[model samples]
Target: MTTTPMPVLEELSAAEALRLMAGVPVGRVVFTEGALPAIRPVHFVLDDGGIVFRIVGAQRLADGLHNTVVAFQTDEYQADRGDGWTVTATGHATRITDQDEIARLARQLPLPWSDRGHMFRIEPELVTGRRLTR
Candidate 1:
């Protein structure tokens, strides 16, 4: 009888986790809506040790997330090799209202959707990551 090898799980340092997060463009933002948990997939950029993303016509979501604790997660998996890594950042999210900052971020991170939207930044207080290796 053949036996399959067990996968090993490794914890990543904050710096390495952040580095991995920077390599990905899309992640999930977890927040609360109507006192219930909700998650949205968004295109994001790692900037100055923070996560920046935009939302369009989502006033309720923006209001709910602004100045509130949230979680941002991104992961990459290689099914063929059965190895992958996932990173999660938890922090308080704040809306960006400055015109110049908004313009600069728009230039730096281009989103796939329309330009009209609100921008938010989440300065992570806790960053955790794990890698699964075969």
Candidate 2:
């Protein structure tokens, strides 16, 4: 069988990054537990110039809620040539517990791909990304 060629890889600008983020609904949240790092896929929304999502029964994730400094990323990948685009945003996350805040954000974010949702908010301090086109 013949294989397809890979697309060119390019760096995405800040504007492009934000635009790309606006289109996607899921991303990975990276955090550290003791010495090891963990990443989990989460459905999120871009609101108030930040990221917000709900978590159900994530104990480890609940621990990370202590601080806002975290790494959130979204990307696309292909196995054939291992080509894709990934955008990583380094920022702090805040657990929104206030009833008013939750209600407001809830109105803005419908629901994630999961049945039970735990809401969390993240504000990016630095954003960097690369795109690989085939």
Backbone clashes in each candidate structure, one number apiece? 0, 8
lDDT (tens digit, per residue) of candidate 1 on 25-118: 8899998889889888888888898899887656887887899999999999998888999999999999999988888887777545425678
What residue pairs clash in candidate 2, if any at all? 6-134, 7-133, 7-134, 54-118, 54-119, 55-118, 68-92, 68-93
**Per-candidate TM-score against the hidden true structure:** 0.93, 0.80
Tens-digit per-residue lDDT, 20-84, candidate 2: 87778788888776667877788888887888877665676676564748888998778776687
Q: TM-score for model 2?
A: 0.80
Candidates' RMSD to native:
1.5, 2.9
Show the lowest summed lDDT stretch of 10 residues, model 2: 109-118
Worst 10 residues of 1 by lDDT: 108-117
TM-score of 1: 0.93
